[model samples]
Target: MELKKLLEQQSAEAWEKYIPSLSIDCVIFSFYENALHVLTVNMKDQNLWGLPGGYVQKDENVDDAAMRILKDRTGTENIYLQQFYTFGNLKRSESAFEAYDDSIWNKQRFVSIGYYALAEHSQVKLRIDQYSNAVEWKLIETLPEFMMDHRAIFDKALLTLREQLNNHPIGYNLLPEKFTMPELQKLYEAILGKKLNRGNFYRKILRYDILIKLDESRKGGAHKAPDLYSFDLTKYNEALKEGLKGNW
Candidate 1:
């Protein structure tokens, strides 16, 4: 009873008594129209664009902060958010403060933890904050002038995603519920930034046996109809644990 009474009494003043200097930045990536897309927001007083990011609240966990940031900026939740890295170089602090206004500088110094997330583009409804002028999707190849080291952070996230593509079945996140093999192949090519052998790539993915063919095809009439396939999450999870280790 004493501990509970103390906890109730101290809860209101806990934040004012102690504050941690930590922040979360999310590199939200999606695949659209055969290209990779990244979510960016422009600050109200600055001309630069940057990834959706925010400082962690006093009572929030790091992972919860990341999810809250995503929801605040893009109206997205419950997506795959993974911590890719922690950028703690001394220079990073200077750059981040420089990107902001004098009012923000009044706060204590902070080091940011970076997280990258993958979600379907259609699932998000962006909500611009008071400090942000607008939020929009930009092609990964043609990014605008970003604040601080966000560009570097984005590059690292993409590199991490590409490295794990072969071992994991994340490429499915880039596709619709039912998609053609060519569309799936194009997503891999976009991320890998290389042209893959068509026949060889198809055979390699088929060997996983994680895709189920559906009785559907393209609605147009210009070219041959390709078979549609949906990812089998159960088998894909099993294959991910086994790792993709066949001849390519």
Candidate 2:
């Protein structure tokens, strides 16, 4: 059967199972190769890509639904997720369903709850659902055409992350358990879209007191081995609750 026909058949069932006119979209970010990337899926029969998303079930809490969706795509539940914004612009997602009848659940004007997530790149196991042809991480700087208003959604999520850097500690989820000071700084630089003074960055991060220097140093790099550090969960959690004191 054709994809649209298949969707039309499922439309009725979707309306019965989910809340009307509501959906969730996630911006899943990860750091790798000294760059930032976002998880995207290329929907079947469409040239454009979109953020990983799904409808909200009638009986499920919004936060739980978000967690469920993230877990379905990434194969992990240890991600750091935050609801950043809600997108309800007129005709935002309607054009994509233009071929379907008005009765089709997907044709409705959806009010999407936007969430931004951080996960370790190596830890994520990307999965593709029935509607998608490909599920992969795309570099933020070179994103392809995005479906509907997903580009706007992504831009807002990135801005929120950059703003949060001013007050909160980040990278516990994006980085490995043990990482070098330079790696940590590179992650920050990737998100902030700028370079930082190595000396100043080292001093400020140390002052934050969120990391513990491990005895071991990274091995086999061209340059001298740098010390490894891990987050002190207790202090990190404390900093998360009571906002950190300075800017980058």
Clashing pairs in 1: none
Candidate 2 residues 1-248, lDDT tens each?
Answer: 55688899899899899999999999999988877899999988865699999988999999999999999999999889999999999999999988889988989999999999998888899998888889999999999989999999999999998888745546787788899988899988888888999999999889989899999999997999999999998988777676666433
Q: For residues 1-248, could you state the per-residue lDDT of candidate 1 as single tens digits?
A: 33224434544454353345676789998887878899998866555699888767667788888898888877878677888888766565455445334334313355779998888888989887765778999998899988877888888889988888866667767678888888899888878889999999999899889999998887886888888899999988787776766434
lDDT (C-alpha, whole model) for all candidates:
0.77, 0.90
TM-scores for every predicted model: 0.86, 0.94
lDDT for model 1, on a 0 to 1 scale? 0.77
Tell me, by TM-score, which candidate is best.
Answer: 2
